[model samples]
Target: MKYNLFISLFVISICSVLAEVYFEEKFKDDSWEKNWVYSKHPGKEFGKFVRTAGKFFNNEEEDKGIQTSEDARFYAISRKFKPFSNEGKDLVIQFTVKHEQDIDCGGGYVKVFDCSLKEEDLHGETPYLLMFGPDICGPGRKIVHAIINYNGKNNLIKKEIACKDGVYSHAYTFVIKPDNTYEILIDGEKVEGGDIEADWDLLPPKTIKDPDAKKPEDWDDRATIPDPDDKKPEDWDQPEHIPDPEATKPDDWDDEMDGEWEPPQIDNPDYKGEWSPKQIDNPNYKGEWVHPEIPNPEYKADPALYKKPEICAIGFDLWQVKSGTIFDNILITDDLEYAKEQLKNLKDKQEGEKKAKQALDDAAKEKKSDEKDDDSEEDEDAEEDDVKPVEEPEHDEL
Candidate 1:
């Protein structure tokens, strides 16, 4: 049994290593510009991208990626790969993003477009097969967008997935399976997953309320009703407000000169609110009348909801209020296990960034402390000089 288990583990490892990868971009160097095209579309201020690992990173060269260089501008850049369809396999989109600017309002997402999309023509209006990543605006709108194009319409995922809002690198993974189910991951942890149909309006529901079915005329759906036998108490009714006995009218000159004086009204202590008959278990209550459901005639089963016929291009077509978001390690593949393996180093990247940042912070704090010490010593010397008795002329003292 142990031998069989060992063989099984070996096979799984081999399969994971051999998983297919359709496209990947690490932006290792300036050569990335050769493959990525910038948008030249009219009537917009397009931002440029710089190759950098930013202020902190695990490995300088390995962590380097394309960073947005300008603020309050539109950025549209895309790279085209060999067209491929995820017909009978899982579609995995994984990438790492660092909002080094502590972005206030921006999109750190990538849009996946089909082969028909021109690299130069990519823009906000361009239709895409899938759009997945973090989008944040102010404090309330920090969320990961999982939008899929279905039958010429783009449907957004109804669920809200909170995104990492810090100034460190975070990995976002979206996996769509052939069975019309999906999984969303952040930093190698599963955050959300479910049936695509349930999460998005990709297809009409299989069953719907029957329009022909109607509630009977005598159907009593109320679970509770006022008891006819129980009447309101005689003193249950009371005015909501009453004149304050302690409040006396001001002793003024004459009623003719000024408005008539009256005591101010206050909340009545004896008030019992509005009077109503007590409720009891409803007789002949039928609970809720649920409409019978039938198989929707307009609904059709789509086994290909997961298919994107020709995904060939991936792009960043977004607007940013504050830029300096570095996008790196983008991967589009049909292998879930491979995508998982690729993201295994995400935690290390984040921890490395944290360590680097902490070092910088420590250095700054030490510098401040040293300056304070120097100031204190200088102040003490000045005090000593001030207190030192003036060397009066000895002859004058004599």
Candidate 2:
């Protein structure tokens, strides 16, 4: 009995680690630094004068350690990461940034890509970046404090943050799924805005600062990501239950933020929700726990798939999954074209209505002028009759 209990506990521990989302580099070296690419686009989709720690990675550094902001251009410090196909369910690029910069945009960010940032990999992959900064999300240039991107449209994950100074190692996390629906978390706070199902365009919505508005001075938000899997686990406890340290945060990094992790009860037996992959039911199960037992709600029920609902097979009304969602149509080949056509039709109809109104106005004006002329002629006739033969009378009087 003791041996069985020990085996069960060991298996459960390994399962928890597999389920969570985090950046893990199993194998890294001097070449990894070269993968961090440098980018400088001021007042653009990301912001003005934005830099990352990943960009400064010089291939010359054989030791590949102790990178600082002054070390390279925009202090771009990042390593190329690629998870095996058989890896866990989802992955996220998590990091902490100290808000240290001359301008308000100084803060850190987390960027995750579907593929590795390799020379052979090139530009085919799309990156989803979560940015956190001091820009307030209101009137002034509509600067977004937090943003996530996919294709062309920038999904403004956070807006309206109090722009302030100091080193705030903010945590920026975004979700990864085949469907592409995602959410943002900052310092454990969840950002609630916009739909991930919406098309990808890192560009801010019109609700942000008007495109024509004067731009603000640019600044970069960056951070140093120490390996969490390092020997001692610097900022975390040895166990997975360990929490992050209380660090300085952006002005709006408050209790009300959407993606922030709620405090967990250290001891609760009744709680059954699993946060890691290890908690999934055994694959050997011949029952409903397997994929076959669960009917594909997306497709028309094939008579062959008829089966009972297992513990995992139960579907929730709130969570509806379509057979297939258009994940990447940012260029808007079909649906966007249809929308534009509808818009043009509406505009043409409006123009036609305006022309009809102008014609009616012109007709009314012409009719009023004609009435005035007739009334004047009638008055002249009356005056002529009233005057009688004034001219002949004058001659007779003379």
Candidate 3:
């Protein structure tokens, strides 16, 4: 018994470590250039990716990430790795994206590709297993996409997940389990979660309403009906609009020059239009009819729909109208606790960055105010100089 217990514990420990981490990237230095590959094909123009400190939170030593250097250009960069399968384990992809330029229209997302991808000619049409992150363009479209490629078709999440709108670092996480459940997290907090079968159109439904089923001939779906006993009374037939009984024309009213004056009409209080029988409980009415369900013939069980058999590369293939988006602290793991620990470190760094940014903003505002004051004083001096001094009275030769 003691030996068996020891073996079980050892196996559990190994499993735990296996779930800890599969890949991680902090982009702390230029070492990323050695592992990452960029598009080599010639195009109209492509933005350069550089490793540098964040625009707002500059802790010269620590705050380092990869950012797009140019504006109005396309960016395609990817890193290749050993192929791994997420067959029986949970898949988690977490990364931090910072739009330091307050991006107007851009895509700050990452794509996971299989080994069959051609990294040299990467573009929008390249096949990818998953595309996860924020895509912001104008006011109407600010969404965090959780798209997956299933059976040669791309499926988008049915629900709209809004992305954070600001100039700060935000962590976006996508987690998928073997049970066909998925969750989306922003800054370590879950924002969306549900069954993948319901959220995406990966397959046809298991059961559908029977098209052959029809309503019975005597079926009554109405909830209310007119009362047959109610009838309109003779006095209820009053006119809706009647001539005013007390109104009279003014004495100064003219009939030839000004048009003929007439008494103002008023509404009749007792008038009721077109009376009908009151509605009463519909005793013969039945409840709503629900069509019988039938098994869908087109639906086939795909246990590996959420599996990526050979995920060997990850890339950022996007377009940016205005650039300067920093991406950092990317992690791919199955251990939630490990991901949370990394996120805590990022949160701490962001707090420090926030304080630094606030101080810089305050100083800028003060400088602008001082400049305005100086401009106002200069305008006043100019106005005084423009005024002509009173000319001394000129006498004949005095």
**Top-TM-score structure, candidate number:** 1
lDDT agreement with native, every candidate: 0.91, 0.33, 0.87
In candidate 1, stretches whose alpha carbon ends up further than 4 angstroms from where it belongs are: 1-13, 246-266, 367-398
TM-score of 1: 0.86
Over 4 Å off in model 3, which ranges? Answer: 1-21, 31-46, 69-74, 138-140, 233-274, 394-398
Q: How would you encode candidate 3's per-residue C-alpha lDDT over 74-107 as one tens digit per residue?
A: 9998988777888888899999998988899999
- Structural similarity to truth (TM-score) of each candidate: 0.86, 0.30, 0.83
Give candidate 2's TM-score.
Answer: 0.30
Cα lDDT tens digits for candidate 1, 1-398: 99999998898789877777899999877899999999888888899999999988888889999999998999999999988888888889999999998999999999999888887877889989999999999999999999999989999999999999989999999999999999999987899999998899999989999999999999998889998988888888889899999987677646788768777899999999877788898888998999999999999988888888788899999999998999999998877777777877778888999999889889999999999999999999999988967695657545
Residues 1-398, candidate 2: write the lDDT tens digits.
99999998777566544443223331134343354443332321211122232211112121122223321123222333333331223323333333322223222333333343332222213343333333321234323245544333446543344332222223333433333344444444555433443433333332333334442334222223333333532333234342334434456656676566444434333334433222333333333221123332333312211111110100000000111000000110112122222222333433443454466569999999999999999999999889855464345545
- 295 Cα displacement, candidate 2 (Å): 30
RMSD values, in order shown: 3.7, 35.6, 4.8
At residue 292, give the lDDT of candidate 1: 100
User: How much RMSD separates candidate 2 from the native structure?
Assistant: 35.6
Show the lowest summed lDDT stretch of 10 residues, model 2.
311-320
